[model samples]
Target: MSLRIDVAGLRPERVSVAPSPLAELGMALHALAEPGHHPGLQGWVTAVTAGLDPHLADRMCEADFLWRTTFSDLFLPCAGIPGRTALPGATLADELDLLDKLTDEQFVDCALEFICAPGYDLPSAGVVSDPELRRRAFDLAATRGPRQVRFTRRLLDDPPRVRAWLRQFLRDCDEAFFADVWARVRPPLAADARLKTDLLRRKGLAETLTSVSSAVTLDEEAARITVDKLVVGRSATGDGGLLLVPTSLGWPHLMVLHRYGWQPVLHYPVGSPEPAAPPSVEQLALRMTALSHPVRMRICRMLARSAYTTTELAQVHGVSAPEISRHLTLLKKAGLVTTRRRGRYLLHQLDVAVVARLGSDFLEGILR
Candidate 1:
């Protein structure tokens, strides 16, 4: 079913792009646990060395324990999206910190609510009232599927020991697997962030949403973003602004998840699956930013026609010498223009190759 996001009051300034090592780790584990869902990840999963260890790779990360859908929220929470962190970036510690504070009642409430929530994406799905829904859900969860979150069961049955098991299991799993997965995933995640940040700035969310692949669409009239997903449905955001987070792990799919009692997050992959390619997102961002301004665009055009000293370019515009120089410096920094000392001042010449590259293939990459 399709997920509809109400963006009626949304603005580009309200949207932000972020990275999540925790979600990436969850994805890696999910791929391992349910290779059937993500056939594309098979190659990378086979190549990962950390989870190869039999002992450390215990049943903790199995497909059942961390169910691909409903139950996975227990470990990663909020559709496996990590909670907000005061840390510099997404971290395992932050996830653990949030989990550590989960009260017994809170834990049970979350587990039951998600496990019992109607798996209905369409209006056609049968509607069940709240009282009957929870009662039926609890009854079904008692026998519907095997208990996936084993620790949580103990949490309700015998609260004391579950904490220790959970703490140790989480720490050991993070150390043995997530740490390595995050290290490998960070560069691409950073690149994706750069690409989105550039798109958000230059093109704004409408254009940026288009580049996030065809599966995501923005209806400007309705101010809604529709995402095609397996079971995802409509969700309205709260006061917290919509968060757009990119990932390297789920390279091909767009994930629309509720961030647990907070704002909703639209998590999806960056344009390129190949992260090591030249003109990385950050590089592209710098170049695009350098060329974005009206004055800078004029400078590039003027320089393209003929070489000119910073003073000469300044004279044409009749602006301050310092301002013209600033624009010229940005262009040079992006390698879009070259400078050489011609007697007294530097003569800036348009770097035809850089412009052509950015205009053609680089432009396609940005759109991708």
Candidate 2:
């Protein structure tokens, strides 16, 4: 049967309005996929930590990376592919172009479909608005497998149900898988044992874990696995805070904690608000305002990966240097980006940290 899925129904909550669980997941996964220098992910980690016990949050971050890695490896093989064609050796720009062509609505729909479907099922089949596009999506899914087709259909029918299924699905991931993965990761995590010892000395391991556990009812095995995975052979410091690598998967643990009814104490930077305070409506307005200008937003997205010269930005965006400069100036003023002098040229990079904070604040307001 032929189907035409309206990408509109899959609308994700605006990043500037309220944070959707899906957006949280996306941010987390994005962080796990690209470990360092993604300020957007770091901002998320910081926001989540604001409401969590420092030690527990740290552990959750460690565990989250493992989960994220497994999830990515299992699904979304096309993640590395940049564009519509999925060329054999596509450049990052090519992949980004594919991403760029996708409307926010289309991208969210695909993400919902991906999470809802069983492993590696492509939902592109039912999403094509045109007959030709439908055929191509179908062809791609078919080449992958029957499972992909079936899963995509399920995703098209009801995404929330699929998301619920995923929670349970994660609960059921083999205990051994986590155990083995932990064994592989434990050594490096332990390399800085003194920090762990200091954290324990300050708060005590049991108290820290208990405080965090109160917020989320982790399965006994899951909790044990996490402790074993992260704390084994590690020493704590006097302050009871240890620096643990953060990951996208950690957000789920935070969600799970929130679900269990524990209130975490969030710490924000000097200029930011406390996590407990309602997100300012004005912040949301600012983000929406920022996104309202398509050309400017596009410029922001392009600069997100790396800095670009004014001339280079103009060429990539198909605009004049004067126009590009105008937009860049506005972006800089908004604290959305920064520029540096490079060999008589200016380069720009996305102020991801600011974006993350803006995103977190906006979402928190809406969700509340």
Candidate 3:
């Protein structure tokens, strides 16, 4: 599947790279809830999880769905216009203030869109007002997973309360760990934005788009940009243009919010690229040792073809879940495997790019 963004009407001014603390905050929660997805942030995730109180941990679990679906979309730029707001440069408080301004209806409406059809064009609020249409949308969202069903029920029952909960939840997260995280990531995010801005100025938009990630490509003649994604979607930039948000936690995946009633957004990874840095001698040795086990090698081979949960792997390999999980921990620490939330389960997959890069990385390290 691929996403095609019609950039025929897009202006150079329409594209800008900027930091988003709210987005980062949401992603931080996501990283915490689904730590296995972000192997690179394992240290940070472990530290945060270990330091968290039960109340905070419970809070994070309740809001985990926000990340799985899309938290950044909920905080769309004011008026859905890209350059009209200072959101690109806004602080967490500033963004939260904007979020606070969301009326109950608007909040629920936005939530419904994401819950129903994530990664597609967001229907305008008016379109969502149709009773039958809204019911069908909610029905579709409900079928997604138990989390979606529960969230939908709560949202439909009392949007204002849910809204308040969301606000407080984010506040709790900020007080707990996100504030420090924002502080640490802000400088790098700013620098990355500036670097991309410079790249845009020196190179053309096509080159800039391609540089965003290997998954992104631009067709100058077609005046379109295509993102290789799991979801198939297509939309035009329209007059609102595109907002390019750079995030430190957005690695391993790319997000495109091509929606109606808002400017399209492309959230790309920044700061350091994948494999962030070359592996150390000890790290390479560990990786090699991880694959030395026949069972672990077979598991890697299976994951290279498709993602599977620990239970599923156990069933297939005729091993107990506990044993599979133990082996997975070793592989995860070795950076040979990574996991992401698929419905209610964590789906583990082989990090093929990392695996392929191992040989070159080892050679480069030795040569250096």
Candidate 4:
């Protein structure tokens, strides 16, 4: 499945790179929820969680439904439809203020659209109107886990209370840790935005979009940006335009908020991060050696497009399954490829992050 965003009529004014405090806060909460997933933020996560009020910590646990998903629509101001002009100077307080503008019904409706649904689609959007549909939404949420159900119940049962609680929770989080972190991260985020905007001007939109993530590609002929995602959908940029938000906490993951009737917001992780210890010479050699082979290079390129099993790779490459497996083993050893079991098939995909940092690692290692 893929998301195809039509940008045939998109212009420089319509494409923007901005930093979002609400988006960062949502990511921070997700880091707190699943600290193990973000090894780079381990120290910060531990410190922040330890400093959080016990009640606030407990609230975050209950609000797992809010931050756990890629679609943290609650954090997106103006349904993510407001264009570039409105987003440049947006602060956390500015975003939070917009929340007060939502009427009780509008708030409940929006929550149901995002929270109740099993997936993002037209059918899921109407889950708010029908009792039977709402029950299905609850059943789907329950299937995800208990936390999803708990969070959904709070929103469904009493939206007004949930709204106030959510606002206060964010404020408490700002007071505890996020405010300081936001201040520290904003400069780089803005710098990244400026750099990307400049790139957009020089390279044109297609090349710029392709540069964002391995999962994203632009077909200049079709004038569409295709995103390799678990969900399949299509959207046009329209007048609302596209918002390219740069995030610090949302690393190693790209998020797209392309709901129908709203501006498509693509939240991509900024390229720069807090400096860390360089890789060892041994580690660098392993990665370089893995990519040195002609067959392995081809495999890496194929895996970049989509995940493939050994047999599938063999068929595509006109090689034996064992031969493909041997190549994959070397790539895995170098941490260049990762495998996930889907039913009986072990699907292998390129580790885009590791590959992306290869040049920088080589340069830094050589200079050192």
Best by TM-score: 4
What would the per-residue lDDT of candidate 4 be over residues 192-299, giving only the tens digit for each residue?
A: 888888989899787677667655778888888887654568877866577888888776556777665556778887763423444555667889999999999999
Q: Write the per-residue lDDT of candidate 2 for residues 1-368, one digit (tens) a residue.
A: 11111112111110001111222233344454444424434664455446545544443443242243322221221222322112211222232343344333344244433333322223233352445644445465566567555544454455445444543333222131223333443343333233434544675443433333222112332222122111112111111111212122333222111000111111101112234333244445655676679998888888888888888888988889999888887777666788888787878999887787886655434422
Indicate whether candidate 1 or candidate 4 has the larger TM-score: 4
The lDDT of each candidate is 0.62, 0.39, 0.74, 0.75
Model 3 per-residue lDDT at 127: 28
Worst 10 residues of 4 by lDDT: 80-89
Give a tens-digit lDDT track for model 3, residues 1-368.
Answer: 57788888777876778888888887787677666556789999999899998997887776465675445467554435333333453787777777767566556666766567532365554423457765776688768777777887787767778888988888888888888999888998889888888999899787787778766789998888987664567877766567788888856556786665556678877754445355655677779899999999999999999999999999999989999999999999999999999779999999999899987666433422
Against the hidden true structure, what lDDT does model 2 obtain?
0.39
TM-score of each model, in listed order: 0.59, 0.25, 0.69, 0.69
Number of colliding residue pairs in each model? 0, 20, 0, 0
- Go through the candidates in order and give the C-alpha RMSD of each one to the true structure: 15.5, 21.0, 13.1, 10.8
N/CA/C clash count, model 2: 20
Query: What is candidate 1's lDDT per residue for 1-368, written digit by digit as tens?
Result: 45777767665666777786656665766666666556567786676644366765654543234445422444444332233322223677776665656555444544444445544332212212245544555565566455634433444455436556655766776776668778877887778778888988998788887777565678888878877554446765534467776767665445676534444667777644533333544556779899889998888889999999888998998898899988887887777899888788789989987778775445334323
Count of backbone collisions within predicted model 3: 0
Q: What shift in Å separates residue 179 of candidate 3 from its native position after superposition?
A: 0.8
* lDDT score of residue 44 within candidate 3: 96
